[model samples]
Target chain A: MAPALREFCYWMDRYRRVWRGTVVISVANPLLFLAAMGAGLGKLVDANHSGHLTGTPYLDFLAPGLLAAAAMQTGVIEATFPVFQSARSGGNYPAAAATPMRPVDILGGHLLFVAFRVLLSGLLFLAVVVAFGVVGPARALLAAGPVLLTGMAFAAPLMGWAVGVDRQSRLNGLYRFVVMPLYMFSGTFFPISQLPHWLRSVATCTPLYQGVALTRGAGLGGSHPGATAVHVGYLLALTAAGVWAARRSYTRRLNR
Target chain B: MGDESAGAGVLIEAVGLRKVHTPRGGGEATEAVAGIDFRVHRGEAFGFLGPNGAGKSTTMRMVAAVSPVSGGTLRVLGMDPKTHGPAIRARLGSVPQDDTLDTELTVRENLLVYGRYFGLPRAEIRERATQLLDFARLVDKADEQVEALSGGMRRRLTIARSLVNRPDILLLDEPTTGLDPQARHLLWERLFRLKQEGVTLLLTTHYMDEAEQLCDRLVVMDHGRIVAQGTPRGLIAGHCTREVLELRFDDQEAAAGKIRHLGDRQEKLPDRLLVYADDGEDALKAVHRTGVEPLTALVRRSGLEDVFLTLTGRTLVD
Candidate 1:
């Protein structure tokens, strides 16, 4: 635990210098996205089919879904490039390995750092969601649970996968093929009920869809205890699996 | 191998150490560090002298406890690496062949963060960073990112980072392989100072001059095996003569037949022939007496290069 925190401190020290650039992505960009896509486009959808969105305001429906998706994007972004860079030959992991720190410590530290970023982004994003009247204070507080877990579910696994990636260009493909598709299809913009029946079932199983469902459920008012547990459980399972994979991969690559 | 240092405590020992690396894609298993044995004393500057791919770095990796030894009895800091890697590593400082400085961090932060890896307190690390910055001569660039530094500065920073833990044994693998002559000299001076400070040093290099300069005792490795092990002067004395006379001829094979008897032994290269004798000048006169007016002739004292040539029939650096 101490060694892992040391690795986390290394990232924190680096982050202190680069925090300004991240604010734009984590806070401003998501707000801008809310304004343009939620309020700007919501007015159109609300007027044409006022009751189509379950008799709730379109901004209310879109905000929490967007928050969950943003967390997913943040998770993937945080995990991909930096993880690949460290796993490369002559990169940071080998340097870290030379110290008393073990491979598990290195992996734990970076994942902890990613979780920090996701939490910071989630908090700031939720603050704006409340400021925009998207969700009330109590509901926004509830929504934070899924928002942060959603980030880890994606973060832990993608970090594991990123370690094995051979090329930098493949990360671009991940954003295009994996992340963007989930963002578009996983009930972020509209209800998954609007999709084809078979595709809706597929979306339901995805971690992002679970995230969107939980956040939207919390924002809209409430959900059954059983449904909430399933959402949280699914995300937890993926995160655990991802962390296990990451530890194995890091030890294999570094310890030789 | 250093009989004089036998009374000193052994900090690292390997008996018939072996490392076999099976390729990831299912090829023949390559024996990287074939059966070898050596011991490093507490404060001696030991080295592994060999050409590239001679298993010098492989052996260093094993000593560092980063790579698992396939077969053999190996101990570092009186502990088995397989069971006590972290404990062993806590007392070891490693400077890899390539500079692994964090390009993302500032010059001083490299030391700070690495110190934290060893669980150094923040205040202690800050004080140490100040001293290490001065040591590496990068005080002016302490806040600058590593990417902004020159190759030499980066190498210096790496060495400084390795020292942040105040380690007992410092392992450097080809520490000056890619540096300029001036950079290499400055690094050697820094390393010499560390030796004066009583830090146990273990390094590997393909440069015979580097070995001769830094190492008190070294082992010559070829194709994953130790070909010879001793002090540089001792190996040269045992395998070669007091001096060497180099003669270049247009036809080395024909000229070799004529002057072969002049020296104690001879080594034929594509461009020149080396004549070993007690006195190189006398050997040169003997070659002249043979009427072989070689293209060029030079006489110099024998060194590790000659020792390796005699032992392995190959140069240290290709």
Candidate 2:
């Protein structure tokens, strides 16, 4: 256990060296998105809709959804290629296998790193949200809870998918076919209520849809505690399932 | 001795160990390690002498506790690898066939992280990493990423990483497979020092000279089975005559028919013929007496390669 912790610290420190540029680029993306969609299109929406109850300032309405989208993007990007590279081409897992650390430690450490990165990125995005005046400081801090949950929900299954893929082609297909669609349809940029009924039902079942709902609800000062609990529960369940599947794949691939 | 087996000092023991790998193409299963048994005592260098795909690496992986045993009883330091993998792995250092160093990290960080994996303290890891950098002669490159180093340097760094925990048993799989003569000699010298320090070293290689130089005892494997086993000298003495006279012939027919009666034991290769005898010089003189004009003639002492050919009925090289 001590050794695993040390190894985790080493991995985190190594990540710090390599991810400096990635952190900068990641922080810049949300700010760019906020500027383009929130401020640019937001002004037009504010000018058009004067007294509609469903209409808040466009930037305020878009802020929580953008945070959820950033979390998803961060989670999927970190969870896929890098995990696959470490498992296959990079030989990091094999190196760890030669040590006293078990497969569980390796998987747990990677998930922990992903969780930490998501938290850090989510915090940065929240700061952006606060600067945009979309939410107060109190609500912004509270937003981290749902943002992290959303990130973990996406990361868990993606990590499982990454572990199961031995070749890069399969992972690329997964990203193109499955992840891209989920990102477009999971109500990150618009309310699911605007989609068709069947599509809305489909979105409601997805983990990301639940993530966006919970986060946007919390960020906008709307209270739907029961619904938020259900989303949180689903995310936790997905995390467990993804972890189990990833662990199975890791043991199967590594133990010859 | 209180018990006859008590003083044997067996550090590694395997009984009927077998490993069957399922082929990717849905064909018949390939047995990488067919049931074989051996034991290594403390402070002895053991070698597995075999050609490629002969189960040497598979056996080493099982001994290293990285690969599970399919069927057999195997123990390292009196602990079952299946149940006590972490404990056994903690006490063993392994240099795999391929260098698996973390390329993203510096040479010093590689050692420090590996030491930390063994639960070493931060202060101890720092001190050990420094010493290992010196030992691998990579002190100048300690801050450089491993990918920037040459192959020999990376190999040395891996060797250094293996010693981070100061393991009792060290397993090296083909340590000098692709090294040039100078690099090979440097590695041999380093390993020789480790032997002097009383670390039990186990290795496998295709280089017969490496076996003779580093191994106190060796087993020859072919087609996933142990074909021969003994000390290098003992195996050479038992299986082959003392010397060999190698003869090259430009004309194949004339050499084959003419040199049939030169020695009691002989082998015919594609371009040359080997005459095995107690006295190579005498055998060469006798061949000359036969008036067979050979293109080249040389006398050399027999080694493990001779034992391998004699047991397997084929040369070590394909």
Best by TM-score: 1
Worst 10 residues of 1 chain B by lDDT: B1-10
* Deviation from native of the Cα of residue B100 in model 2, angstroms: 1.6
The superposed Cα distance between candidate 1 and the true structure at residue B216, in angstroms, equals: 1.0
Cand. 1 TM to true fold = 0.93
Q: Candidate 2, DockQ to 2 decimals?
A: 0.60
Say which candidate scores most in DockQ: 1
Q: Residue B289 lDDT in model 1?
A: 90
lDDT of 1 by residue, B78-125 (tens): 888888899889889999988888888889878888888998788999
Go through the candidates in order and give each one's DockQ.
0.70, 0.60
Best by lDDT: 1
